[model samples]
Target: MSTTTAPEAAEAPAAPQLSHGLKQRHLSMIALGGVIGAGLFVGSGAGIAVAGPGIILAFVAAGLLVMLIMRMLGEMSAAHPASGSFSVHAEREIGPWAGLTTGWLYWVMIGVAVAVEATAAGAIMHSWVTGVPAFVWVGIFMAFFCATNLTAVKNFGEFEFWFAAIKITAIVAFLTLGVLGVTGVIGHAPGTANLTGRGGFLPHGGDGLITGLLPAVFAYGGLEAVTIAAAESDDPRRNVANAVRTAVWRIAIFYIGTMALAVTLVPWDDPDVVALGPYVTVLQLLNVPGAALAMKIVVLIALLSAMNANIYSASRMVYSLVTRGLGPRALAKVTGGVPRLSVLASCGFGFAAVLAGYIWPDTIFLWLLNSTGVAILVLWLFIGAAQLRMRRRVERENPDLLTVRMWAFPYLTWLAIAAVVALLALMTTSADNRAQLYAAGVLVTALGAVGLWHQRCTAATAATAQEPGRTP
Candidate 1:
């Protein structure tokens, strides 16, 4: 039986084939846009509220973790580029169950994010034109993206390029404004006094600093999308490495630098910090005319851009999973090098979530967010575990395949796993994030069961085929 299994494994096909459809520019811009999200534009206010001026520290801490995760993922992706990214790595390194779990979890994450982004865009649109209902705008946004994704990959790349450009331009403008404000070049110098003025740098003590990390960590969630996008690029390994290398610096500079300026320009404890968006607050402090209106436009663009990317990523991931035999095979087919049916199926759930949000107007969206939050956690955990296993396997199988490698190999991989565990443990202690911890536990258990079942089924099928002279 062992001898028979060996030949079957040896004859198994190489990983699923994907069209090298995306370009380097598309990937680079995706990386840039990944680091900029509604969180940086609107949601950083929550972090500022918790940690006072020490939110800078939170951004730095979270950025480091993101950098580490990207490095581990890059190593695996460079060696075996695939559309599924970490999900493919999980199957090769860990087991089939790991792939199933991480793939489905990530699919849920992208779906929920699409709904969240669409809702955010709708809110902004309704604010601008009270006569247009939010649900109408939501439907419009979904329909537009569904068409975009169903087109050829190059067209999708073109769309992402512009979408990412808008968000990147906004961040650059915000950073420039911050520098001028800090140097006292724009009106009176707000000075660094806001940092220590209200409650000192560490006003709320270590607890506040730790509490601030929750949102800061969440802000970096989208960066991994770049690695997945890299699989479809013409030069997968080179582009993935370049994007990962450059994106780390951009995230730190843009996210940490902007948050530092934000906390410095205005008192972290200011009442308006929570009410008005942080970026808008900075503009208002600079006394820029119509700054609030300008920021609303930027936020709307940011939300739309995120929605577009999430829809694309979700569809591509499902297509990849299906090709690997982990999902419905029909989804794996490509028409004009685009998975048309898969794109629609992926967006269908997102549209449903949006409709549910509109109907309930309250509870459903929050539950969706909670359920999907666990998915992000599961994804990082799998990336870390898969990298650890794959690194060793690569050394044994192909020692020359270390052109782009993780910094510390097994050590860094283990540390990343520890960091994921710590974050999960920390989530349990938070009133708001505790629900995510429970959800993550349920997901992990379900994945484990499914993996075991797949292994048994495969073994049984192999044994049955051997008993009869009936070849599979």
Candidate 2:
């Protein structure tokens, strides 16, 4: 897992190489599927319980912020696509230190998330087949995805396509069924009772709406995967631009629209609602046939889809670092430009996290989860900063290359930056979120220190090498 480079291979990569194996269909589905995380299906219950039916407004606000961030990211990604993604942008617009810091932090975050997803999938399996140990199921899921990633880039795309398809279909079907039930078209649902009776939509007042914003912001975290996946796309510029523009609105529809139906069909304060997950609770009330089993299947697909997406993004990121001589040299080796070693390393970290979860649930295990809690904000902060600089440079020097410009130029971009700052500030208000903020602070600090040290070493080595030709 150490990123140390081998002596002989510790040189600049000869080329930035990767196969353009991801098809247009894969790119489209990745954008759609990225937003439909398993967390939304299960974890949203907690957010709803806190915010009440006013959660829809909270989602709208957060969704708008994300739309702006994507605009900034899309602007840069289209002009210059690389597997390193925001890291590559950071290096060009900010410095190598920023790129290395963001790249490794995000890379490690993705690896950790893989473990989290595997554990979630395993739990669902445990529910069905009560006899099997959850850890064993986690191992099988990890291995299955590992093999899927190790073989070929195209194979990864295919796997993700089907996985995403199932997730998307389930969400759509849920929305449809929710509407029917609320209207008494099918099943028993008290229309508007949940939304209206729930303290007139804001059980906890405006504070509840603000409270709902936290989960909504977090839920929108995975949309950045589209930009990352666009690098290996056939036409990076167009693909990135297309995905960003199209995915943003579609994601808004899926997230906000789904929340509206959920809150309408199921009251926010229903007993044991959060414990059962709102989807399951609603389906049970509506008396859907095999609702429990069907919903469980959907949840499993959601987890696996996330696993596939994160593993792909994490490996590509590490491969980017190695290609640029930022990590271990062995990871730079690519067969069919897939960087199989990098994938293995990424999955390895995930499995290691799984073991840590078993050994130290309260200590290291909790830290592992909290450490990357605010990474989405950190990434957006960098993206916003990088865009503020890169936008001017692109406009002045490479005007024609600016395919996907940030809307309203600096105005909206800066607005997005301010929103991220506000979200981070607000996150501290809750004890639960405060733990995440504190842990993320430690992580950013550690990465920053390492980045500075690496920068200094690179500088010193260059200075010494140049001294050999001195005339003195």
Candidate 3:
């Protein structure tokens, strides 16, 4: 009998393989778009409802956490860029299961978000044109974005650049107008009384501020999209590092600063804030004629912009998963450096979800949204874990490759995990969010089952081949 030992594998580095057509400006705007979504334009109402004038604190706290998460992600992404971003990091540092779970969860999240954004745009359009149904508008939006994403990657970046530019312009304009109004330069100079007068700034108490953090965190959900987009950008490492480094200041100015000016210009509990819309409320107070109408256009653009980005993200994520042999291989095919089949398949799902909502008219969208609620959090958790593992390996292997390291090393990584756990706990406390916790559990179980099944099949195949005295 001859005993053979397993041979040691060569330690050859894998070559990087991602298309790079995205320019610097496109990368910057993609980062900007990720931070500024329909959440800031429309969903801010929900946070305002809970926190009153203290929502500013909620935004600030959430922004800090998001900054920490982005930094960690940046460190890993800069060190080894991948189309799957953090998921690829998970596969390298943790295991294939981690990558599979995080990648599919994020893909589902983006798909559902596409439906949500389309429905939002549909609702707005239905308001203006009473004859058309909301689902019809959703259909139109799905088709529009489907075509956009099915084209080259540059086309998608171009569209998002304009979308983000509009949102950025609107926020800056809002802030400028706000300062003018507060200083008695533009309108009646509402002053800071709106902040102090209405329930003394902390109107709803600390609980309100805590509750407000939920939606505020949601507002920062899309910032990770920038890292994914970096996979297709020129100089992805530098672009991702720059974007993550500057994310904090941009979010502070756009979200916290804008919300501060909003509450300062008008009372948190003002009827206009609740009824007319936050942006419109401030504009109306400034006696800006046709301002409400103008903002309606801006909000529409915001919704469309979100829809476009969501479709692009979902397609690319699915493409990455397919290439890893976790999904259908057809989705991995790229023509003109674009995942055409994946784009079609993703948009098909979006269209189907929208149609189901239209036909059921009862619980489709709600279920979709709840199912994807904890997914972003799941992605962040994986990112934190992957970064923790990968950073150590990178240090051991190549200590000099530390251009964009996370601050505080293992401590900050653990802190991020703790924060994610707390957020999950908080989700259980709310009736509206409790469903998400349940959905997350079910998703985890499903992913585990699939992974185990795949492992068993692979093992069986190897065993059968070995029995036949053939190589597996």
TM-score of 1: 0.94
Most accurate candidate by lDDT = 2
RMSD in Å for all candidates: 2.8, 3.8, 4.1
**Candidate 3 residue-wise lDDT, 157-258, digit = tens:** 999899989989989998999888888898677666877886887888877887898888878888877888888888888888888788667877799987
Q: Which of candidates 2 and 3 reaches a greater TM-score? A: 2
Question: What TM-score against the true fold does each predicted structure earn?
Answer: 0.94, 0.94, 0.92
Q: List candidate 3 stretches off by more than 4 Å.
A: 1-18, 459-468
Better of 2 and 3 by lDDT: 2
Model 1 lDDT tens row, 1-472: 0112222121123334446778889998888886578888888998899899999999998888888898888788777777788887877776666677788778877898898889889878988789999878988999998898888777778877887888788788888988898898997887668987877998899889988987888888888788888878999888998888888878788889989989988888877788886898998999888888887887787788888888888887887777766778877767776778789999998998887777865577666677777567678888888778778778998967666788877787788789878877888778778887766567667767886687568668888887867787
lDDT of 2: 0.84
In candidate 2, position 100 carries an lDDT of: 82
What lDDT would each prediction earn against the true structure?
A: 0.80, 0.84, 0.79
TM-score of 2: 0.94
